[model samples]
Each structure stands twice: as structure tokens, then as C-alpha cells.
Target: MVHVILTHEVKDFFAWKKVYEEGEPLRTKSGIKMTGVYTSVDNPNQVTLTGECASAELVYRFMSQPELKAAMQAAGVISAPDMKVLNKV
Candidate 1:
């Protein structure tokens, strides 16, 4: 499986979470198979999201989508996210 990791800071975790949850259908349709979200213990505003995707290409496409960027902005993501794509060893 392909894995996608994303880390970013948000203005409000709960608000961002609500928007993230609302994007489930879009994510699924874009080829995400499963997803997990976590917040940093040191800083609650720092969030990490991991998703299992069918392929790295799909994940790349998902991340590059304008809609996703707009949604993240609306969700209060305050900084550009760091992203990584991995393949299970």
C-alpha cells in the first residue's frame, strides 16, 4: 500500500478537524483507502495526518488539488503542510 504523511499547523484543531471530517467523501473518491489523524503533545495546533492510498500518484494528485488547498485554508491551516509519500517495506 502507498502511505501519505502530512504535517501542518492549524489555527484551531477542532475547526480543522471538522473540515477534515467533512472531506471524507472527497478523500475516498480521490483514492484514499484509510486515514489516521494525530495532534502533537507538545503543541496541540500541530497536526499530523496519515492516509493509505492505492498509489503514490493518486496521493500526489490529491495533494495537488486546488479544492484541497481551499478546504485547508477554510479549515484554518495557518502554514504550508509538509508531505511525504512512502511505500510499505
Candidate 2:
């Protein structure tokens, strides 16, 4: 399995959470299995989402969709996301 670490800004914790919850079905449909998620204690807007996937390519494909990008932008994630792909030790 491949692991993905996504760092992005969160406009509002509750609002972003709503978006995350709303996207749960899509995540599953795209072959993502969420391992965990984190938000900065000092700055709630900074979020890190960790998940396992069959392929990094697949994850990128799903997240790069126009609708997904638009939703993220609406949520106040202004900058391009930083994605870290990992492998199990």
C-alpha cells in the first residue's frame, strides 16, 4: 500500500469538516482507505490528512479533479497542496 500525506489550509474547522465528511463516499469510491487525520494545535487551519491507497497515481487522479480543487478553494485552501507519498517500513 502507498501512504499519502496532504497538507492544506482549513478555512474553518467546522466547515472543512463538513466538506470532509461529505467527501467520504468519494474517497472510498476512489480506493482510499483513511488511516488518520490531523490539524495543527496552534493553527487549526493547517491540516494533515493521512491515508493509504493502492496507488499514488490513483490518489492524485482523484484529488486533482476540478470539482475537488474548487471545493478546496472554497474552503480557503489557497495554495497548491503539498503531497507526500510514503511506503511502509
Candidate closest to the true structure, highest TM-score: 1
**Alpha carbon lDDT at 15, candidate 2:** 83
In candidate 2, which residue ranges exceed 4 Å CA deviation? none
Model 1: weakest 10-residue lDDT segment is: 27-36
Any idea what lDDT model 2 has? 0.83
Q: For every candidate structure, what is the RMSD over all alpha carbons to the true structure, in angstroms?
A: 0.9, 1.3
Q: Count backbone overlaps in model 1.
A: 0
Q: Which one wins on lDDT?
A: 1
lDDT for model 1, on a 0 to 1 scale? 0.90
Question: On residues 1-89, what C-alpha lDDT tens digit does candidate 1 reach at each position?
Answer: 78888899999999999998999888889988657899999999999998798888898898889999899999999989999899899
For residues 52-88, could you state the per-residue lDDT of candidate 2 as single tens digits? 9998898989887887777786666755789998988
TM-score of each: 0.94, 0.88
lDDT values, one for every candidate: 0.90, 0.83
